[model samples]
Target: MTFFLLRFIFACLLLPCLWTTASAEAVSFPELGSAVPGHGDVTYLDLARMVIPDLAADKDGFFRGSIPIEMRHIAGPDYDGSPPATSGLSSGDVLNIKAGGKDRLAMLLDLGDSPDSAEGYAVLALYDITGKPALLDAVNVAVDRSTYFRDPGKLSIGPGDDVIITTSTHFNSSQGYVIAPLVMVRNDRFELIDMIYTFDENLCTNRRTQNVAFQAIADSQLYAAIKVTVTDATVPGDESCDGQPPPEASSRDISVTYHWDKNASRYVKDSDALDRLADDNAKRF
Candidate 1:
């Protein structure tokens, strides 16, 4: 009976150790590739390669090749199984910024199959001083043809250390490239706080169109120089035309300044100055 009692006690003691051993067994994630220690500091490229084992690296040790289609998040948000987009790390498709006194990384990902179309979404991932990563935000930006020919978009640090992202996309009515909605990272989140410059085709019968060009001007204050060009449709002398010879093509320039509203903890446009600029531009053209 004493031997049996000792055996029972020994088995009970071993139960906890067995449970601990099982618990300590490294978690196996087939999708994330081989298990590696100290994975907390993995960069975007590291994660990309894990998800896409066939990815190739460039001469500069950067991954610049396209991603496999099977690794994309096509239907829903399955971040564990597949990343939503792909990026060319060597082509300025990734941006690092500082916001709220923390390091933030953003990447423009290609979501479409057509290499000629810059149709993709964006992800802003935040990391701490220790390099622990977290997803700050994600957004779907309009595709721009220019991106296919060059880098996907431009990301910069705006006034008050805010993140500014610029992209170009096609507007059907505009019939040309128009600036996508300006995205700003404020309060650790992505916010579309500014209006985009677009063309209105209904104003004239000859299909007069307008296009806006923008540049970020940073000094003591954050400013954007927006140049708007209105192009009147040219009617052939032999073709029959409808309404009054469409208004003459004209161009207007405006400067918009942004201010950080402490109360809201976000950047707000200078309404009075914007109104004045709009009025002046309206009178000019």
Candidate 2:
């Protein structure tokens, strides 16, 4: 009888230790100070925990169609100061915007890379006015740099109330390239329609000579124009003299236009419009 009693006491002592170990392993949020350009020492998982309670209510059906309780960082810089050099990065602004005539909250987050890994990602979330939030999109972008959305006003609202957000990876500062993705939210679900790349660079044989431009059309359509120049650099003779240079490069200019297609739910290339623009330029010259 004494032996069985002692065994029961030992089993009770081991149970708590095992439970503690299992809880530690189950933690999903990354530890603080692991990644750069982080969201002011807060992880997206952390934010999700803090806001999950508000996402549902006892009396209402899930969200209840009311604006989220908290919003900040909207119409302001996403993060303050440089990465690595700065210890604490400020979380960007969160704002409430109307999409499809419905109020929604938009926010940006920087999920820093793992301690031993260099990979990181950026997250954009849109919360319905009813307090329910959905992750609109997440991209594989650098966390150490200021790549999150900075201006709340820059979010372009489409005719159907689709939201267009502009983000970039600053791997090459001189190129100043950006990627704009259009997001559609419906029935508490987020969908990505398309992505547009814009940049200006002078390469050896090809160049993006002009910055991409956007215009709003009458039918709730968005228009974009991009200019590129390509050159043929070929030498007539393989043997070259010491003081002589190769043949001068021959170049040609081309312009492309894109229009949002509501039926297709994405942007499509418009060759006819591009040709017309080219003809107009030719007449002016």
Candidate 3:
């Protein structure tokens, strides 16, 4: 009897220790303040100012409805920016404008990179410009998915009214990206919704089963949404991305959706638009 009691006590003690160890390995929300590998010029200000998009809100639904990102650093600057930088389409850089494209505000936002998968920081900005027609209302983008190897930050921001961002990695899955999504949302008033990651993937192509995934958002009440996606676009057997990505314009594509439902009092995906979302919520440099 004493032996069994002692064994029980020992097992209890070991369990807690194991729990702590496992918990430590898990990643959480917004990897803000994380370094960008190099670029000493990038002060913490750069990191703090940076906004990475969570796959949950980017890869799919973004193109389904509502606002769309026109252009940014992704175009190398000339395509956007106040001064014009590079070829006008690098990969990940962002800007925002009013609804109709009247007010133009540009932020030199940064995108983080990762060696393991598509990586970078992303920041989204939006505005109301019912005056201009050749303009836009919001700008969303990703950054730094270069030939890297570390688990660089893969998150974005929805800074409220004119902004939105990534939830936490807790919303992500073990496949290297978020599966369900614990995204932070706001309008005039910003607040992190306290819901567990409970969504599903609707898009992903040319990758492993359950390994690659995508997400989308739609508003049944307002008729709007943002989408997100993830895929091992890197060359086959070359996970480091040190090699060229298969092709953004690939004929094959995969995607999913996430959206809000007035009747359900939550997000729902009555539709899907994977390819369009990839082009919209693009990664930044």
Per-candidate TM-score against the hidden true structure = 0.45, 0.43, 0.25
Q: Which stretches of candidate 1 lie over 4 Å from their true place?
A: 1-43, 47-92, 113-134, 143-160, 171-174, 200-247, 272-285
Segments in model 2 whose C-alpha atoms lie over 4 Å from true places: 1-89, 114-119, 130-146, 150-162, 173-175, 201-210, 220-267, 271-285
Looking at model 1, which ten-residue stretch has the lowest summed lDDT? Answer: 19-28
Q: Please write out the lDDT profile of model 3 over residues 1-285, one tens digit for every residue.
A: 342253234334223212122232122222223322233344222322222222122343221112123434321333232311211111222233221113332232322222232433233433222232111223323322211101111222221222222221211231322212223323322222211122122223223222222222333334345443333232223232444443333222344545555686544543445434434333310
Q: In order, how many clashes per candidate?
A: 0, 9, 71
Alpha-carbon local distance difference test for all models: 0.40, 0.37, 0.28
lDDT for position 194 in model 2: 41
Question: Superposing all C-alpha atoms, what RMSD in Å does each candidate have to the true structure?
Answer: 21.5, 20.9, 21.7
Please name the candidate that would achieve the greatest TM-score relative to the true structure.
1
lDDT of 3 at 169: 23
> What RMSD does model 3 have?
21.7
